[model samples]
Structures are given as C-alpha cells and as structure tokens.
Target: MNHKAWSIHFIYAGVILLLAGGQMYAVESYQLTPSATKFLAHNVGPGPETAQGAINHFMVNSNTGVRETITPPGWVAWAALSAGAVLSVHGGMLIANKR
Candidate 1:
C-alpha cells in the first residue's frame, strides 16, 4: 500500500484504539454509588416511590441494590453521527484516489 493509504489506515486505527481505551478506563473507574442513582431516580421521575420500589425489589430479591441504567435518545443519534463521519471520510479518500 502507498504512504497515503497507510497514513489513513493508521489514523483510523489510532482513533479506534483511543476510543476503546477511553471507554475501558471509564468502565474501570466507574462506581455505582447509591446516591448518584438515587438522585437520577428522583429527578428523572419514574417517581420517588417507583424508584424506591425498584431499589427495595432488587435488595430483597437479589441481595443487591438496583442499578438504574439511563441512556438518553441523543446518545444513539450521536453514535450514528460518528459512524457516518467515519464512513464519509473513508469513502471520500477511496473515491478521491481511484484511478
């Protein structure tokens, strides 16, 4: 492969590696403290009672507290945007170099 092709490949690989590393670091550092989830449960309101009910249910039934995993709709949209950007860059490079 040519220098330009190698450069693009390296750049893409570097970005993917960086993202993966950051994600792994985040997961390793993440702590699920009760207060944070409690605050989310309170403000986002499936209602305080419902939130507490979930906590109680988990504690009683599973011997562990509830984990409220909230992913907003915009997250998926942003992921799609990122994927589009990568694909567009790849396509543009490929098409521009076609002989």
Candidate 2:
C-alpha cells in the first residue's frame, strides 16, 4: 500500500490504542459491554486460557451490561500510551510530507 494509506492506518490505530490505554489507566476495573449472544451465557474465570484477548482478564456476566473486567499492569498501560503517542505523531509527520 501507499505511504499515505499506511499513515492514515497508523493514525487510526494509534488513536484507538491511546483510548484503550487511557481507559485502562483511569479505572481499576471497567465493564465491557458485549454484542455477541455467546457472551451472555456464562462467566469466564481468569485461567491460563479463556478467550483470545481476555486471557489475562476476569470476565463475569450475570444478566448485566458488563462483560469483562480487565486489570492491566502499570507498565503495560504506560507502554501502550507511549506507543500510541509516538504512532500518532509519526503519522502526522508522514501526512505532512505527502503534502
């Protein structure tokens, strides 16, 4: 793909990562609303393996709007935030060069 397209992708992905990192840092535990009917079934324990991304999380759904509760490590959250900022700035620079 072109550099412009990659830049745009980077910007979008960075923004999403920044948002996720901010949420992870802001709250100790947050609810993840599920759109799938399968998630409405049972609660998931924090075992070695559960779901793909939910491996390290504890997910419990008891007829509530909440789906998963994630408690990310401090370093992971900071790293994500830093990476997001870097990617976003890099994408902006790429776009500037394209002009």
* Candidate 1 to truth, TM: 0.29
Q: Extract clashing residue pairs from model 2.
A: none
Models 1 onward score TM values of: 0.29, 0.60
lDDT of 2: 0.70
RMSD of each candidate relative to the true structure: 10.0, 6.6
Which candidate ranks first by lDDT, i.e. highest?
2
TM-score of 2: 0.60
| The 10-residue segment with the lowest total lDDT in model 2 | 53-62
RMSD of 1: 10.0
